[model samples]
Structure formats: structure tokens, C-alpha cells
Target: MDDNKNLFKQIQALYRGLFAFVVAFALIGVGLIAYMNNPQLFTSDITASETEYVPIPEDDSDKIEDGVHVRTGFVEADGLMETVNNCTNCHSSELVLQNRMSKENWIATIRWMQETQNLWDLGGNEEIIVAYLVKNYPVIKKGRRGALTDIEWYDL
Candidate 1:
């Protein structure tokens, strides 16, 4: 009984000691924070490197909060609400945004997802989603800039 009491007493002493140390460190941290002027911290000009400065080009993409660009769940469009309600269940909105397809292609892609990727039949919502996707993300004409013209080659 006496031995058990002694062990508990020792444990209690150790716990008290640890508590005091933790409290001391916390108090010191608080004191340091209280002693400092917050304005100086923000106003100080500090830079690790000043070799090169290249500004990012502005994009029309919407930012949730100005000054910081955070990717949003959905882009602003006519059928945005319908698209969000139907899509974004299996994949991210970013994925949808990245892909561009025609109306027919979008329909085919949705069918493929339903058949293989375990996507449920979107039913009436499918048309709305397809319209939204086609309107926002149309197939780009990816080819040469101008019409082809036959040019005569002369030996150098």
C-alpha cells in the first residue's frame, strides 16, 4: 500500500513539474508577442531574392477572393446551376473546365462515363449539362493560321 502511494506521489510530482514548464514557455511566448509592435512586422521589407521579377499575366478566370486566386467550384455561365446540380459528383469542376468538346462529343463522353465509369444516367439533367458544357467549352479550330497556297521552290 505504502509503495503504491509513493509511486503515485512521484507521478503527481512529475506531472506538476511538466505543467509548470509548459506554462512557463507559454507565458514567455505571450510576453514576447505583447512586447513587439505588430505594425513593424508588416511594414518591414524583406526579400530572400531580388534577381528577377516577372509578373503573372492577368486571366479572366474568377477568383473567390480578390488579391488571392482560389479556383472556384464552378465558372459563371448560363446553366451553371444546372451543371453544378448534375455534374461535380464523380469529378471536380476543374476537370470539366479543362475539357472542350462539341455537343455530340459531350453526349458521347457522358454515355461512356455511364457505361464504364459507373456514372448514373443524368436523365433530363444531361441535356442541361451538355448545353452548358458545349456553350462554355467549344471545340477550338486547331490548325494552321491561313489557307494553304502552292509556292514554287527555287534551288539555292
Candidate 2:
């Protein structure tokens, strides 16, 4: 009975070792498959020459009426990039888009920001940014929706 008990204990230990080996083998196989799929994950060496640089076009004519920019969603115009760099630094472009104020109002808003919101002086770039805002997004009179036309009313 003592010999049988010792044999059972040895068998259990062997099974546990085999299980652990199988699990380790599976993990290694999974890692190998992942590496095979995308070897770039394992590669740490990246050369500077491999990096890509996109040049900004000198011509503004194509972009003037080319519609809104994909990333910023700012209307395409002469000073689109300038406006993006300056305005979007502080707040979201949506804040600019939603309020279609005139040049004077825009300046007032800028002044208010400067006084209260810790906005820095824009200097000469202010002209470009303001021009972009005024020309592209002038004050729109959206008083009310068209008089609730074509609606069927039920009697209470």
C-alpha cells in the first residue's frame, strides 16, 4: 500500500510538469505566430532615413476653394493653415465654427480672451487669422426654422 501511494504521488507530479511544459510551448508558439504576422513589432532599430516628410504646397489657389480640411474641418481658404495654427492652439475649432461673428466682434472676442482667458497677443498673424475667420465664417442670421410647415396636428 505504501509503494502504491508513492507511485500515485510521482504520477501526479509528472502530470503537473507535463501540463506546465505544454502551456509554455503554447505561449511560445503564439508569440512566434504573432512575430511572423508583424515582424515590425519585434524590430527596435528604426533609421532616420526611413521617416517620411510631406512638403506643404506653395500654391494656395487649389486649396482656396478645395472645401474643408479633413483633420481640422476648417473651411479651405488662403490662410487656412495660419488660422489652424493660431486659433486651434487654445480651443477647439468648433468654437470658431459655431459662432459666425464679424471682424469687429471676432476682435472683441479675442480681446476678451486676452483679458480673461490668458490668451497671448497674436501680433501680425492676427490679421491673417481674423481675415480667415471673417471671410470664411461671417455672421449668419438663423432667426428661426421655417414656420413648422407640412405638420399634421391632432385635436386634444
Candidate 3:
């Protein structure tokens, strides 16, 4: 009975401590919010903090317009006009952008599209489109990171 009482008292003490810690964290969060809203209330006589106020940049120059997104870079190439003429009639530029293939692979893909997706024959324009795809969208060797070593496996 005495041992059980002691264990219960320990658990009660632990819960009280946890509750106190949570209340302290909440109060600190509320205080920080209030201070941010009205700095004058919290800065009566305290020295300046080490943190400096760095204003966020307010410029649109950072926004780059790839031809795919902004119609600027897409139609600039010689053979790309043929690609756009035939390609966009069926699917989006996003589909083309996602794929990276060689000239032979591009031709194979076109043949597959004709066979399955009911794409029309490009005739002489197929060569132009293939050249453009090979030149612009060759296979990008994305060296992905391998699985993480020394992982600390845990159970819930």
C-alpha cells in the first residue's frame, strides 16, 4: 500500500511539473506576441537586443520567367516553333518539360503517342521536333542522395 502511494505521488508530481511547464511556455508565447505588437510596453528601460531589424526585400526581379511559365523563352528556338505547333495542340508544355530524352527516344515517344494517344504524324516536322528536344531536354543526370546511414530506428 505504501509503495503504491509513493508511486502515485511521484506520478502526480510529474504531471504537476508538466502542467507548470506548459503554462510557462504559453505565458511566454503570449508575452512575446504582446511585445511584438507593442514593443514600447516591453522596452521601457532594457538595453537593445543583439538582433537587428532586417527589412524583407520587396522586388519582383527575383521572379524568373522561364519560357514554359511566361511565353518568353519557349518560342525563341528555330525548331521549337514546330514543336509548339504540334505538341501544345494535344498536351501542355509541362509534359515536355518533365521528360528528358535523346533524338531516337524522342522519335520513339512520338511513335508511341501516335500508336496509343492518337497523335498525328509530324512527317518532316518530326525531325525538327526531335532535334529541338535533344538539344534542349537531354537526360539530366540527377545524382540523388542515397539512403541515410546510421538511422536511429524507434518504436512508438
Candidate 4:
């Protein structure tokens, strides 16, 4: 009878240890889950602000290359020149210079900007802008053996 009581006590003690281990493991798991779900709440001293960088305009005169006529800019055509001036009034000239688009695409983008983004009507300047973008910013083709072969694909 005494041995039976000792055996029962051992079993009870084992069960209690197992229960405590299980409770500790569950608490650790809950802690991990909470940390993952709310990382900012667990962390100390951090904040963020949304910001955008705008490019500064470059002087057109400085961009004139050698052998180019003084009267004409990179886009010497009167129509294109007029478009560049009109478009760059709101945005930087660099934005206009960096983007390459087909004539149709450029017209559609301009129209969208005007209709939705409060961009003013081009007022006869659309033709000049379209021509300039088409001429200078033609769709680039890949896999050509030219001076650009050494340049990185992303850079082009």
C-alpha cells in the first residue's frame, strides 16, 4: 500500500512538471507571435517620414554640345522646342528629357495629365511636344552592336 502511494506521488509530480513545461512553452510561443505581429510596439525610438526628391533644372546653354548650332538646342526644331518649354514650366526639364515614349503614347500621357492631374491644356503646344519626344525619345531597341554595346543594359 505504501509503495502504491509512492508511485502515485511520483506520477503526480511528473504530470505537474510536464504541465509547467507546456505552459512555459506556450507562453514563449505567444510572446514570439506578439513580437512578430507588433514589432514597432516592442521596439523603442524609431519614426519615418515620406519624402520625394525633385531634380534641379540644368541650364540649356550648358548642355549644348560641340559642333551644334548655337541657335538650336538638343532639339533644335521650333515645334519640339516650344513643347519642351511649355511642358517644363510645371515639371523639371529633366523629367521631359529622361522619359522616352512614342508620339501617340506621349499625347495620351499628356492628355491624361491634363484631364486628371490638373495639368493645363497645351493649347497648340501638343504638336511640338509630341514631335520632340518622338524625335529625341524614340523607343529604344535591344541587341544592337553599336557604341552602346559596352554600356550596361539598365543604363541605356
Q: What TM-score, computed on C-alpha atoms, does each candidate reach?
A: 0.45, 0.49, 0.45, 0.44
TM-score of 4: 0.44
Residue-by-residue lDDT tens digits, candidate 2, 5-70 = 999999999999999999999999999999999887677757744777878867643243358775
| TM-score for candidate 1 | 0.45
Backbone clash tally (model 1): 0
What ranges in model 4 sit over 4 Å off?
1-74, 144-156
CA lDDT of each prediction against the hidden true structure: 0.76, 0.85, 0.79, 0.71
Alpha-carbon shift of residue 60 in model 1 (angstroms): 20
Candidate 3, 1-156: lDDT as tens digits: 999999999999999999999999999999999999988776665455656788998774223355442432353456867887788777787788788997788889999999999999889998888888888888876698888999999999
Candidate 4, residues 1-156, lDDT tens digits: the string is 999999999999999999999999999999999989977656664443234556887666524356332433345544655765577667766676677888788988898889987888777777767876787777877675666456656755
Instruction: Predict model 3's lDDT versus the native.
Output: 0.79
lDDT of 4: 0.71
- Model number with the top TM-score: 2
TM-score of candidate 2 on Cα atoms, chains taken together = 0.49
Q: Write the per-residue lDDT of candidate 1 for residues 76-151, one digit (tens) a residue.
A: 6677667766677778877777889999999998999889999887877888888878977889978868876798
